[model samples]
Target chain A: MDVRSQVSMVFHLDKCIGCHTCSIACKNIWTDRKGAEYMWWNNVETKPGTGYPTKWEDQNIYQGGWERNGDSVSLKGAGKLRGLKNIFHNPYMPVLDDYYEPWTYKYQDLFTAPEGNDQPTARPVSLVTGETMDVKAGPNWDDDLGGSPDYARQDVNMQKLTPAEQEVMFQLERMTLHYLPRICNHCLNPACVASCPSGALYKRGEDGVVLINQERCRAWRMCVTACPYKKSYYNWHTGKSEKCVLCYPRLESGQAPACFHSCVGRIRYLGVMLYDADKIEAVASVPEDQIVQAQMDIYLDPFDPKVIEEAKKNGIADSTIEAAQKSPVYKFVKLWKLALPLHPEFRTLPNLFYVPALLPSVGTVNNGIYNSNTNGLWGGIDTTRLPMKYLASLFSAGNTETVAEVLKRLMTVRWHRRNVTVGDVDEKTVNAALEDTKMDTATADAIFRLTTLATFDERFVIPPAHREESIEMLENTGDVKGNTGFGFKERPARGL
Target chain B: MFNATLNQFLFVIFPYAALAVFLVGSIYRYKNKGFSVSSISSQFLEGRKLFWGSQPFHWGLLILFFGHLIAFLFPRAVLAWNGEPVRLLILEIASFGFGLSAFIGLGLLILRRVTTPRITVVTSKMDVVVFLILLTQIVSGLCVAYFNRWGSSWFAAFLTPYLRSIFVFDPDITAISGVNSWWLKIHVVSAFSIIAIIPFTRFMHFLVYPVDYLWRSYQQVIWNWDRRTIRNSTKHSEGEKSTNN
Candidate 1:
């Protein structure tokens, strides 16, 4: 496998407290300017509620991403493949209002005194009409990911749901709903990077981070509409599109991204994962159900000596190899095999992965509820009387069968034990599963290995060679040039 | 000092000349540039709320402008029909109301331009100019409405007579004699200047109205063969030899 090829991220949702510290830190660093106030490079959202500007997850309104057409992948809603052959641009993206309206206080109203007032009261007003208004919705409106329970309870339509339906929905909601703190996933097939009319946006080969060349951005805002995630924001003042840079400056000096570094929950994990750049299209174009497996197949095993030898041969830096060897991402994502990508159906091959949350629930036996001796259930109480439908809906999209299966799987308390690696499973059991499933040995071995690791490593330490060089370069040469003589040279040079 | 013939040329001929320049220049520019009917159609068809704001702002401003134009054209006819005192009172009230509407509408537009992220991106220097000019006209008109002197007789005896004299091959600078209000002169001059600049700025939307409305109501042409044929005819010459040859 080509070594300087792929990039991936792993996020541990268990540690996330939904404080929005990452969002604010990112905003203060990148998007607090005149045109960028509406852009939140990092935002944590509550699921099952109207997010930010509103229901952004409803892709029916703004069609984006790719869809399957026969054996080939094609842009959804785009009429013909031939017509899209020389695509100057792709359509269907979110506008500024799709996220949130830019709001400002009417400063002039602060000095205006009431009819009988002796002193001017500092009453904040909306600058739009010099009228009194309040900050309503914008970025980070639902950082906590509070489920639709609150909205459903109050909504007339939700209130009308049948008792069974409500029960299933609520259960499903509790099981599925979790705070998803998102930044630019910097996907393998980034819609924003592909749709740029000027080729201004690019994903760095070294780190898999997407960046926009501010100088080249002509402000057509095509990328703004093409991104399914709505990560790209148009800078109105500068007449350019801007997005999360993934804090390359910080990363170059061996530090985490601003959002990841400032995350109060320390939920974010930054590292390098080698993937087959050649297989990106194939993996991304696969059927939705098969996509997760395709992605898993692409994750390189850092411990494999053959993979390491191949990486070194392909001119992969020793530092990068070292960094990848002990990366927290590798441990949590590949070693544990617990982290899952957000909306794998997006077909962007998003690098960011989250560990599927496990919630508490009582096991149903015939008609009676068998309460599990676990604190996983909210308030540590049996909730079977509340209607299984609600719980099913919340957790498993009303698929009680799947909910039961998942619940059974999660109830195996050994899986929840800290610092347990998938590799610790008995070889006999792993071989038995592999044989029973007719699965490939390597795949079975990797999955088993991932489940054995104990504890998530927080340190994203770079190799000493790369770290020292990057620090020295940053200190001496203020700007890091893009090309950096890595590829054009015939052979890998000795370290400076 | 007031030549009847010169006044006829100045008030009557000059005003019409200025109006003709404004009207013809705007129309010519609109025709030459062609209407951005596609853009308007797209906005309206998309069920965009901006169209609602833009449509009302344009229509309100148009009605307001025509009201002033009619008053300028036939002061005596208006007064005779309603009597001088009633006419004067009506003009003042109408001007005040018109100014208020213009002020409010323009304020909304400016607010949208400033606050709406998408609109702010598309806004140009000409858009700012058009907004500010209209705002100034409304402010000046309101000032004139508030500080009227001699009421009905002043307009009938001085302004109306002067306007009529200018039409009859005569000039009468003395008609403006009693009206020493700097505010009135400032208002008149500013209104005229705004008219002159309208053709150049996005204020040309005023001239685009009826034609734009008619054009937009029509459907888009979607025949591929017809479009290709038109493209070939417009882009290529039949007599030209092939470049390879």
Candidate 2:
């Protein structure tokens, strides 16, 4: 089956509270350097608003990810000859202004300026040019301004909606939004890796973490456009391209990634998954409607004896296989089918899955008491405040049925949990919820525990990274014995 | 006498100087500091005008380069193919078309650099020098081609011999000195100058590929597994038995 183990992640959107704690934690660790001030390796995007770098979903501008050139998927932005042709100027690259120009308040001015009359204030200056600038935008500029005409109305996701529906969404009363916390998907069919003209980015064999080799990076900036998520960034000061490393050093040391570790909502789950490596291209190249199914089909059951045998033969460690068995990501994504990969239409076969948040449209208040038309706790999946069509565009490659199914599964879990905590819900609806899942309360309880109250050990089942063998291959075991996994012995600075 | 010295310097010394610098400098930069060796593409800063300028320039340059190579290296073959008047006229027409496109593209690029604020801000001193040299080369080349019709038919007797003499260390200054046109000489000299400064300029992007990317497979799979790991892992119990013992 050409099975290979990849450390994958799941984020329960229902549990996320839209806090940017994970983003700040990741920033402090990875992207606080000179040219990296603009980079947010972990960003929480508010739905119905253009994301970081603004309108990243607008493929018409950025031109990232893969497109079907018949049966095979070709890089949407760059390929062999096209890379050479555009070597002088990448036509599709996002400018610094496309991402807001990184700026720092001249805090020194606040301290150094002699007291004149009023309170001393800092002026915003561009990080790259050091020129005083009028502050306009930032990484979290549209954080919670969901119904704002400036930000939310510009969301590329609005393209999927009819004009009437779009008009309705922009209304203050009908407006709905949720937080989408994102990191590098570390995809199986990584367009960044494929589009790198210099061949700097590669997926690590042991953990499937995508990493860029600093020595090999020539800063072609093709990876910036080729990545559909706009996750890759060019270090203007260093003359190189950089992106999230997935905190591999933390991973090697058996800790969760910085973003995952600092998640305040505790929505993040980390675990290992085994997928058939051979089917990656075929899965990514499938018709738009069939992409989600194709992606799901490639993830082999870790408990399957034959799949486990194939994984072992492919050099997967025994401990990694064990972790795959315990992976909450596996259960949420594969078994319960509550979690879905973000924008499967991008055809990256993204490893990160999201359990869609419930926001039903029909909730109304009568005499200070909230009521739903359905006798059940929540409305039908089709009646969600965030339209099924929008969720379909985001997660299910425009397939509303799959989005509805995922929503039903999530609502079933919520209903099951409510039945346990309070006895307000009727037995008929409880039985229906159970029947919809085609299971008993035990499965729902397991889903509930993992989603809500799972401990660190339960949420994150990190495999032994097995990077030691690679290190040993490059250097003698004795020479590298006590060395930390952090690459670059010296701190990276500007210029050669 | 001026023409003779110029011919010796341009045809003999200049060719060697440019070739040596182009080869050694490119390799040295590739070995020591590979990342700086890039096109330094200013597209991110400004791109709309670049599409019009870069596309035509690159396409015209590639066609013109191959045409020159075929004429210089195998003049006799090129001449034999163009023996008929119709064939010769067609070839000249095509060459003129490419030359005209390249000139227009270069003009647009120069205009872009001067007019576009973003491009001008990023334009280095070397970028200016390279652009001027290219302009001179293309202008001189176009003049020579227009003034001297059917030069490709007689390339074997003129420039090829001169080039061969330089390669053979014979330094036949008289070969090009007898050509009677300084415009052709200017074109050749400026072309050599462009080659000499290429490694130092953004033009090095065309040559510097430290990694052998041409042959590597599209999908990269980093295999960290070595002998010990391979031995420890097996489809069946065979390797497990060895590890257990």
**Which number leads on lDDT?**
2
Q: Report per-prediction Cα RMSD to one decimal.
A: 15.6, 5.6
lDDT of 1 by residue, A1-496 (tens): 6654344566655456677898889989887777677778888775444554355444565555556667655544332331132122233545555565567755555566456736555555433233555666566554443435544343222332586655664664343345668788888767666655444567665566788766445443556655666677766455567888888787776666788777666666677787666676777777765676687778788778988887766546666777787776776566645566666566777788775444444444445755454433222223533333433433222434433433333223233231145555555544443343344455434433343332233345443335544443223221323335433323445679
lDDT, candidates in the order shown: 0.55, 0.81
Please give, for residues B48-140, the per-residue lDDT of candidate 2 as tens digits.
788788777878877888899899988989989898899999998888788888888889999998987656766789999989998998889
lDDT over C-alpha atoms for residue A369 of model 2: 79
Off by over 4 Å in 2: A33-35, A80-91, A108-121, A214-221, A236-239, A365-374, A377-382, A473-496, B1-9, B81-90, B114-117, B146-154, B168-171, B208-217, B225-229, B232-245
- Which structure among the candidates has the greatest TM-score? 2
Per-candidate TM equals 0.55, 0.87
Candidate 2: CAPRI quality band: acceptable
